[model samples]
Target: MNVSEYLLKRLKEWGLHRVYGYPGDGIGGIDLALQKAVDRGDLEYVQVRHEEMAAFMASAHAKFTGQPGLCIATSGPGAIHLLNGLYDAKMDHVGVVAIMGQQASTCIGANYQQEVDLQSLCKDLANDYVVTVSNPYQIRHAIDRAVRIARDKHVPTVVIIPNDVQIKPFKEAPNAHGFTHTGIGETTFAHVTDVAGLHEAARILNEGERVAILAGAGALNATEALLTVAETLGAGIAKALLGKAAVPDHYPFVTGSMGLLGTKPSWDMMKECDTLLMVGSAFPYSEFLPDPGKAKGVQIDIEPANMSLRYPMDVCLQGDSASVLKALLPLLKPKSNRKWRKKIENNVASWWQLLESRAMQEATPLNPQRVFWELSPRLPDNAIITADSGSVANWYARDLKFRAGMKGSLSGGLASLGAGTPYAISAKMAYPERTVIACMGDGAMQMNGINEMITISKYWKNWSNPRLIVLVLNNEDLNQVTWEERAQSGAGKTEVTQSIPDFPFAKYAELLGLRGIFVNTPDRLGAAWDEALNADRPVILEAKTDPNVPPLPPHITLAQAKAFMTSLIDEPERASTMVNSARQVLASFLPRRRD
Candidate 1:
């Protein structure tokens, strides 16, 4: 057996049957091994446009499957391209493995062409574990340990394989017996609940009124328990962006999302709440939280380092979310006061009304919000939605509310662009039977997704009529950055740097031999969505949307308003944009100060 073959065999045994990467000459041996494995049906190698997309796809696959995702890249530029996607996995706390090629060991310090000090480059970004496999005997131990660390710790690990070492002949492969594999049946398991911690958390809940529940991705496993906690405490549940799936949007007393891309009821709850009970989410934005002294907090997390990292905690309950909540439910006393819940409920209802008005309004060009509004109802019950980062994310986070069975994901903490299409493709590949939709913007789609269309075209015949849609919001502007500049810098006019030339994306999809639909008016949006949903193969729907629409923060500050007004003097054509901001601010029920 050769070293490359042995490494591939070990990865297959670890349950990584699919690998995403763009091949290069440096990893010739490993590439040859992957081709043989694909022929045997032991693995599938996805050829993506850029190496970055490959890493992003691997990250998304792991997040969706709850298993470690694997992506391969050759030496130098290919390896460097993997950093952003790997960082996405590390920041979001998902398991992904990156197998990178290295220059031959013969030229250690010679600084060969495309040679980079990978160990030093990746140590800080891929912090969980980063090592190079230098010897034949070290192959099994290094690859096995990398997979194990990624799965157990839920962090990405990079394995650098030297070119000359990969082609080296070996008489025998290392045994897997001595290694600790974390497979379901082979791994030891236990349910841990902190008895004392739960008691203290309940005590804190009982003593406080106007309680608010903050949930994040950690709460995904304990939805029923989380709801029970919210109901017992008479608290409104607010989800962090990554935790949007923790509870159904229609659930009573559940404020949609928190922070800039948040619901009005959530903003109100944070400002007025007396006690905050956070679960599974280490939400980073502390400014959106209630003042420290105004509210006492109880946080539940499996990782001790995550507890109290974002907000002050009165009781830190360090344990699994589901187990701790199940044990804590019995100790809690239900609140008799419905006043707090009622007030928040009314705010949530009012917020929805405002959203409906903005989304359905008639305009010369289509309102971007309407696209999501019409698409939401058309979504399959088991659909997987992937959103890109930018102005579109605002509508995606606010407009698209999935039911219990639906799944959604994005580059959360990394907040990286160009991952939307890859994430959607990975979801479709992982769950071939379910529908997958990518809500991408023009800038993000053009960045790394334009040529990625070739991937869908080349591989479409393998699926059982997979339902995959790439809905491009073609506003011809980097709308999110433009909005940020306006909101933060008091710049009322859209800067020339943020503008992009419009492209016929629907026609671009046609050139790829996929179904394409173009909609310039709001009236045509419904039909385009329907056609895309029912298509036999992959479909792309491109809409000419309005770029002037701003994704305003939940609560507009006096300073932001002042800066906005000051900057508007530079351009007289921004009156409509100013009015839209005012409407969004008013919808949140901003209180007026008394003189």
Candidate 2:
């Protein structure tokens, strides 16, 4: 047995059936070995165009499958390019194993071409980093440890393998069993000593004042428990975008998401609530938080570091959400405050009404909000939506409603651009029967979208389902950056540098042997969307949009507004044009009733 064969066997033991990556010289020997394994029907390699895309795809696969996804990259630049995607996986808490190829072992100190200290570079981002020793006997143990760290900690781990080691003959080690698979432990209850704190929280709830529950990604594993708590406490629930899978939108307590792109009702509920209970959520946006001086806040989290990190809590309970809720329920007295519940419920109803009204009145050049509204109803019940980091993210995070059993995933904290395409592809691969759509902006699509199309063509050609559909809003500029610049300097200039040069998106999709459609009006959008959803293969719907429109951030300072205005003050004509364009867009969406 050779070192490569031993490594492959260990990966098989780790339950990795597919590996995502591109071939490079540093890993050329291992690649050949993998090919040999493929020929022997021992493994399958899913090739990707770029290492970054490979990492993104692997992250999404790991997140959905609840297993460590593997990504391979060659030495030097290949390993370096994997950082952004790995960081995203780390922040998102998706278990991943990045197998990076290294230069020959003898070239370590010579500064050889494509030689990089990959182990050091990935140290902070990964939970574990191991450089394979030249001795083939150590290969199995190193691979085993890397897999264990990724699976147990729910974080990325790196294992750097030298090119020369691939050909070395494997020597049998005494303890070849490697690591054991461990399942998540059963939930355990924790003792709550804060009797006074529990009473105080119950009193606020029983008083009939508005109350809202905010959930985050941490609550995903405890969705049932969180939902039970919401019902028992009679508190309306609003999830952060990262926590979309925590509860379905159809749930009675579900108001919407809370953030910049969050729903108005969710934001309004946060404001109106005299008492707020944050359950496993560390929503980074302070604007959505209750002012500490005015309203009382209660937080239940497993991580102590997350507590008081965003909003200072009046009552902080450190325990798993399920454990904490079970403990707290028994200590608290049930409240029959119909008025308080009704007040918050009415606010949610009003908010939904406003959303519907807005959607009905929206017209011309097709409002992105209206498009989302139309698309949401048409989506399959088990659809999985993946959003890229850009203006579209803000809209989807707030507006898109998930049907029962439907799931959504996005790059939230590490919010890097160009995740949508790869994420969608991976989601489809993970759940082939479910509808998977990549909602992205033109700016973001240009970043990493094109590569995944090729990946699908190469690997999943015979899969007769249109598992991935990309909805590209082609506004022709980096709208988010342009908005930030305008907001800061009042300059109405569309930063040409951010613009993707001459992107023939539809033509490109067609060239890849995928269906491509260009939509201009609402009618065209509806028809094209319907076609894409039902297509037998992947499709891309490129919609030309108003570039001047901007997705507002959750919180912006008055000082920031002043700076933006200052930029506009110098160029009155350009600023006036921008303002008029915005007004027209708004006017087109304003509510109107036929006489």
State the TM-score for model 1.
Answer: 0.95
lDDT tens per residue, model 2, 1-595: 7887778877887788778888999988788889988898778687888999889988988877778889999999999988888998988877889899899998987999999887778879973555555667677767877787787666898888888987789876663475333322322444553667666656655553566789887677777777776776678898888888788776656878888678666776787777788887768889777776567778888667678778877788776676676667765545566565666677665555545544444334666666676787788878889999877887687667787677788887898999888888778777777778889988787777876778866655645466578888887767676666777766656544656654667778899888888886876767888988888778888877655544544345697767666767554336443554455335434633334
Which pairs clash inside model 1? Answer: none
Per-residue lDDT of model 1, residues 34-74, tens digit only: 99999999998999988999999999998888889999999
Worst 10 residues of 2 by lDDT: 179-188
Model 1 alpha-carbon miss at residue 288, Å: 1.0
Instruction: Candidate 1: list runs displaced more than 4 Å.
Output: 170-191, 572-576, 579-595
Q: Best by lDDT, which number? A: 1
- TM-score for each candidate, following the candidate numbering: 0.95, 0.88
